[model samples]
Target: MVNIFDNKEYLSFFCFIFFSLFFCVFMLFLSSLLGGKSLSRYKHTPFESGIAPVGDTHLHFSVKFYLVAMFFVIFDMEALYLYVWSVSIVETGWTGFIEAFIFILFLLLSLFYLVRIKALNWTHK
Candidate 1:
């Protein structure tokens, strides 16, 4: 029986990893050796568009904004799943089609639930 670790592919993999690490460490060392360390009074201060900021930098956002963002992310992920399933429809055959159909059904049900709960409504209740 041949050892997996003794394979040529494993040798190349190890060499690739070793070189990647060496290159990264060499670049970091070179940068630190040649980089500047100058300090000034303005070094720690925040600069925004070359203008000094005024008033309170921290601002509050509405919870509704967060809710809308969550909804967008959920629907976007569902779209991604459907796209992948579509790409391999032939390989999946009838089983894949039924699974995708159920997935779509669930997606529509969730959307309806969101609507019924008024979660998508923008106006304050």
Candidate 2:
């Protein structure tokens, strides 16, 4: 059995890490020493596109747009998971295929519900 604790290579690796960390901390300290700040009301105020901010940040958004975005994200994630499972289908055999099929069926059912609720309709007028 080899004694890993007795290895010179491991000691040298740790020494390198320690020196790197020390150098990083020293540089940060030097930078902070060079930089100075002055606080003011204008500095604290929120900046927006080089123009003064007007309206409230907590403004209401369209529910339909959010719903459509959520639907897209859910379906996109499902496709990504399906792709990962497809690569290992041979190893997983019929069980994986059945599981993936059921997953797709559930997603389709959800999509059907969304369609019924007019969630996909972009024209609100």
Candidate 3:
């Protein structure tokens, strides 16, 4: 029986790990030596594209933006599920078809609910 510990493959693997660790530590030390400490007030301040920031950064945003973003995410997820089903449709046959139809129905129902609640209406104040 051949001993695995005496194998060249095992020695090479350990050498690769040791060299990777050594290189990473050397690079980190070199970068720290070259980089200077940040002392300027402007460097610490929140930069808004060189424009002086007005009012609070945590001010309330439009609800319409959030609503639109949520709608986009829901629809995007539906598309992804449909794409996955499409690739395996031949293998799953009728069952896959029914499942995809049900998924789309639920998506449509959610859209209807959003419309009824005036969530889709951006014009309303």
Candidate 4:
């Protein structure tokens, strides 16, 4: 069997990995050794703009918020794709335009479906 250490590339790769791990560990060790230690009461508490935190940190969120967020992300990504296609319109010609039209058609259909299902409605129905 050929020794992996005999190959220059394999040896170099192993050396690089070893050095990377050593550097990370050494940096962490140095930081801990040189870092200051604080045992103040507020050390473990959540702080905001030098103000003490009040009330519960974990508040219940409405599912509508997440639904709207997902819709925004999906539409925003579609917009990005359209922007990219528009930038390369000259290269893609009519074919790109047709494809984009079809994509937009599907987007509109999906939006309509969501509206029909009252997905965007904030009212609890």
Candidate 5:
């Protein structure tokens, strides 16, 4: 039996951790200190294709645009999951097949519901 309180390995581990933390802190502060403190007026402004800043930086976007983007991401992730399931279907056998089938059906139903609610109708929104 070994006494946990008198471990030399633990002391070495603690020293390693402290050294790592000190190195990270030293590098971060050194990089910040080396950076330029001054900034030009033009540099602060947003450069839109080098045409200069036009109008206000803040612009209101349509809710429909955001909704469609979110749905696209959700669907893309669903497809990715389906692809992973397909790859594992051989190893998982019948149970995995049934589960993935149900999952695909659920996603299809969700897509149908979104379509019914006109979530993808960009022209009308």
Candidate 6:
């Protein structure tokens, strides 16, 4: 086996990483020491249009909107998987092709079911 420890490239890479980490830590410590001495009392309060905050930060959301968002996210994640399969199509060959087809078919079937069952219907509308 070739001696990896004797390589000049590996030694240079190690030195570069060591210096980068050391510089980062030194800067962070220096900033923490020098930059935190002048904090005002009003700097931490929440400001809203130069007025005091009003009632009820919590607002009601329609379930239909959440349902539509969930469906979009599921389909979006499926598209990402399809993208990965496309990127490595030659490596995965026919087995991957068949599997991806089945996956898409099932996703379509689920979408149809969601539509048929009115899962995506506007409840508030």
Instruction: Compare the candidates by TM-score and give the number of the best one.
Output: 1
Cα lDDT tens digits for candidate 6, 12-99: 9999999999999999999998886768998877798899778877889877778888889999999899999999999999999999
Comparing 2 with 5 on lDDT, the higher-scoring candidate is: 2
Candidate 1 local lDDT, 1-125, one digit each (tens): 98988789999999999999999999999999999997899998889999997988888998889999999999999989999999999999999999999999999999999999999888888
Clash count per candidate: 0, 0, 0, 0, 0, 0
Candidate 1 error regions (>4 Å) = 1-30
How well does candidate 6 match the true structure, expressed as C-alpha RMSD?
Answer: 5.1
> Order of all candidates by TM-score, from best down to worst?
1, 4, 5, 3, 6, 2
What is the C-alpha lDDT profile of model 2 across 35-108, one tens digit per residue?
88778878788877999877778977789878878888999999898998999999989999999999999999
Clashes of 6: 0
lDDT per residue for candidate 4 within 1-125, as digits (tens), equals 99988899998999999999999999999999999999988788876899877778898999899999999999998989999999999999999999999999999999999999999998866
Task: Say which prediction, candidate 2 or candidate 4, comes out ahead on TM-score.
Answer: 4
Model 5 lDDT on a 0 to 1 scale:
0.87
Error of 5 at 103 (Å): 0.5
Candidate 2: which pairs clash? none
Give me the displacement of residue 67 in model 5, in angstroms.
0.7
**Model 6 TM-score (2 dp):** 0.61
Model 3 agreement with the true structure over 1-125: per-residue lDDT tens digits: 99988999999999999999999999999999998888877787787787888887796889889979989998999989999999999998999999999999999999999999989897866
Q: List per-prediction Cα lDDT, in the order shown.
A: 0.94, 0.89, 0.91, 0.94, 0.87, 0.91
- Give the poorly placed runs of model 2, Cα more than 4 Å off: 1-37, 48-59
State the RMSD for candidate 2.
6.4
Q: For candidate 3, which ten residues in a row score worst on lDDT?
A: 39-48
